[model samples]
Target chain A: MRFTRYLAFLNKPYLLLLGYIFLSVVLMNFSDTASLQGVRWALLQVLNVVDSFKTEFTYRKNLEAENERLKKENFYLHITNQRMREMVLENARLRELLNLKTEHSYDFIAARVIAESSEKGINSRVLNVGEQGGVRENMAVVNAEGLVGKIIGVSAHQSIVQVLTDLNCRVGARLEKSREKGIVGWGGDPWLDLEYIPKNIRVEPGELVITSGLSEIYPEGLKIGVVTDFSETDYDMFMSVRVKPAVNFNALEEVFVIKTEIPENIARE
Target chain B: MNKSHLRYLLVFLAALLVQSTIVKYMEIVHWRPDLLLIILVMYAVQYGRKLGSTAGFLVGVSSDLISGGLLGLGALSKTITGFIAGGVSRLFQERSQFIFTLFLGGLIHDLIYFYINTLGKEVAWRVIWFVHIIPNLFYTAIVGMVIYYFAGRWLKADD
Candidate 1:
């Protein structure tokens, strides 16, 4: 009677709950069973629809993270690519300079343009190599293109170069075709003025001008420029010649300093 | 089954669907309220301990199976939570203050679930409490109050 009363109070549903819990415990122990796994797999397939929807909503945050990562990667790649291109161009320029040195039998010291004067009227540059690297006053600096400048001042590890465009610069130049010689100097303009050529000399446009080797500063046959314009005044005994320099001074980066010891015969001549 | 039993089943299914689909958007600081836990708490509080424990076991089993979590883990934790909530029901009248019961029940459920989940893991107690358990408790309580208010009305109307 007591058991029946207790059953009635607990209810039929509660009794079934006890039975279900027992079965669930048994199923839990056999969770790795094929049948249970199959059931779990079936339920998972149904639940995956809801999971996919959740993933779709949450994908924006993930995509943003991935975008930031890619942007950083692209920035690094851009810097590296720029550096690689610069290195390739430098390699080619250095190779050309090496060939020029070998062909001319030049005793040369390579130097990089470290700093340039900011003054507008001044055409001067600072090289990384100085007196410590065998650079001296008035040493000729040239590149594969042509004559650049001369070293005017030297420190232990740095030197100052006065470029050909400077008003103070004067080089002994000779016309390639006629062998006519003149003094090349800047006349407050972009072109160099080749002065002291006799009026009778036949100087023409596009004629090659080179170092005459008479000044003891630059070697013979080193290019100065090509004669661009020439005119003779009736009152003057010399022709006025304008020459465009072979080297682009504005874009100068690397250069070679000639360290040849002058021969007694050539120096005396 | 009976009308009440059918009602509970429908509510459970609806809660599960919302938890899976929409509740993620309600997260604050990467924490979301447990809608299914709220529903389970409400059912356990309305009915007796035996019925409450039974509902918890079934729901926990279903959750584990669907989520591919460890077998019997959720069932064991939820069952204990249901039993505790059922025992605590006697201290307060079920109709006058059912929301309190729901909050307490949800808290207990979360505490038990977190404890079981963190076992054997190297997670600190403070991290588990602050990062996971505390935020979830408050969120579940607030959301559960709203659900209970509407569900209570529906239950009364059905009666």
Candidate 2:
């Protein structure tokens, strides 16, 4: 009966505060004990719920960040798709160039058009191949379409070609149908002039022009251009012939450098 | 728990979040107003010493765990602050008089906290009071006045 009265008396406010004080001091001294650590772990689990609440509350913010990431990814994929399309087109074009080499027995060196030197010499272009790679002066440069130019300058690793469209450049060309030979030259005009073809030579419209191979620079039987129009005049001794070049000079990327023969090492390159 | 008790618990959680996230931005030099202490003082003034100390113990333990501080230090200080604040609730004045109790309780709380935290070091009392305790108490009391202006009716409705 006395112990029950004592327990009832300990339930008072001041006595309860003392009990709490004692508990706090004990907790401070034994904070690192395993039992307290277990309690702390339970409290940490409560905090994890708080962390989950924070995450849900910030959902809109995370969505905005995710939106930014997707935008960057979309742009990167767009650029990659465009590059892949270009690669597909290049693959088909390279396959056509490979067929042109197999069709002809002439040993050829494939060179890429590095730059168009239109500022220095009109229609002059630089090639990635050079003299060290067996690109010598006066070697003919062709493509799958037709003849492009001839090598005029060469260094250890690069060569420059004076394309046929230059004002000073002239090619010995022949009409495949009429067997009429003339000097093909550009006079700052879009169409090439096939000079020295007489009025009675009977050169018709849409005639194919091929290199005569009369010069040491150009090889025989290489396509030069097609005759688009022909006009006869009384004062001129030869008829005026306008020939459109078979190769589109504006879209040139790859070409073949060839002569009578090429070295086996440069052919591998 | 009753509705009022649940409401106070939610308010305490909100204060805890704001204290951790936003209070650092409001810090001046090195001293800051303790929001948890202000809530404890206000709650103690309305309630009695018994409920005041209980709320104080819970808030202190939560703060210690969240801040990774030494355990039980905050509980010891806050328990005494709540008890003293509750004792002064019988003063003959309006509810705004609790600001004085807030200042007193704040000073006492800091004394207990710094004393125990520093292992009863009397050498740092001057620096502790002038630099930390005084400024923090002044700011806490001022903020408590503003909070009472807004939420004092909830406490007064019971009386």
Candidate 3:
């Protein structure tokens, strides 16, 4: 009788909340359960349907203006493509003469952005492509402007991309002018920080930064960002350089996944 | 179940839908408002601490599951926020002060969530507070005002 009275006195809502918390903690510890992933995939599919309807309504209203813009973009791209083809042939001949291997060829798979991280500090996005579309984990994603992110998680019809601005994201980068290699990472700000370059090397503002091909994920010579600021601390041997990313992350609508098979040797690296 | 309970359920579902679809597109300076947090706070203020905390935990869990994030972190942070918001509600009586309550609630929620999420990480507290917490607080508060206005009318009609 005393135990029953004590139970009644305690707030039921609080008890229920505690129970929920306990359950969540247990589920989180075993988060890799296939059932959990299936539920997430199902929810994403339903949400995607709603997202598509909304996008269609908005696109229909701007169809005429978008068509004109696309036409202009297509004309410019055609000219650029011809020049790129010529350069590729010349580069291939040069590589053969140097006895260098041409192993960096990649096919592109286009995907649409479905949803982005809802939390304020987290930087991630969901794409409408998945294993079915040839998107796999660790595949680098890019847009017309530049690199966007890499695939972190994938289901049957959707995948998650850890955008460049995310805290965990890091890329091997090089200064376009000086060719000094460094590790670039998000500094919990809009700008990226380039680290590990010796202070002796002169890095100036407005210098272009690009992928150094050191990272197996990103291709060499892809534009990363432009140097916006540079400084050095007396205690540290490395100069602190800030880079403003080439891609406008806030307005990302579509991206292409680079589908390249990692050779055994490169994969080991 | 009671009619009020059913009403809260609908509000929760609607908030979740809006958050995933519309709110995802409404980013400002890489920060977005927390719509579900606003709903949790409003319900907490209208009802009491116990119910508010319970709602918060549920909302956070649902969000974590849907977004594919670390699960317990959201539940832990939001549960605390709900309890605090319920206590804070006692100090205010004016309908106009609802926005202020929501803002305070949002601020508290973000701070707790940020702390919980970045515990082991080497992120500077100043950056997390300024760059993320502050913007989210103000945006959530603004959105909360709009939601409270419509919610108030809905509640009046139900009565």
Cα shift from native, residue B117, model 3 (Å): 2.2
Segments in model 1 whose C-alpha atoms lie over 4 Å from true places: A1-28, A49-269, B94-96
User: Would candidate 2 be rated incorrect, acceptable, medium or high by CAPRI criteria?
Assistant: incorrect
**What local lDDT score does residue A25 receive in model 1, on the 0 to 100 scale?**
65
Candidate 2, B28: how far from true, in Å? 2.2
Prediction 2 global C-alpha lDDT: 0.71
lDDT of 3 by residue, A1-269 (tens): 98987777347765755766676678668666777777777878877888799889988999999999999999999999999999999999999999999866679999988887666556788899999998877888999898898887788889888888887788999999999999888776687888898999988899999999887789898888999998889999899898999999888888999997755664333
By TM-score, highest first, what's the ranking?
A: 3, 2, 1
Candidate 3 lDDT at A29 equals 81
Chain B TM-score in candidate 3, rounded to 2 decimals? 0.91
Model 3 reproduces a share of the real contacts of: 0.38
TM-score result, candidate 2: 0.47
Against the reference, the lDDT scores of all candidates come to 0.70, 0.71, 0.80
DockQ of 3: 0.53
Q: What is the lDDT of residue B25 in candidate 1?
A: 55
User: Considering every candidate listed, which one attains the maximal TM-score?
Assistant: 3
Per-candidate TM vs. native? 0.45, 0.47, 0.89
lDDT of 2 by residue, B80-157 (tens): 778778877667376456888888888888888767765632233565567667887888787788877887676445
- Model 1 clashes, total count: 0
Write model 2 residue lDDT over A1-269, tens digit each, in one string: 98898888445768767866776787688765666655544444444455456556766668989899999999999999999999978876997888743234577999876544311113466666777788887788999889898876565666667788654478998999988899887633345778899888988778899998776677767898899988888898989888988887666768999855534553333
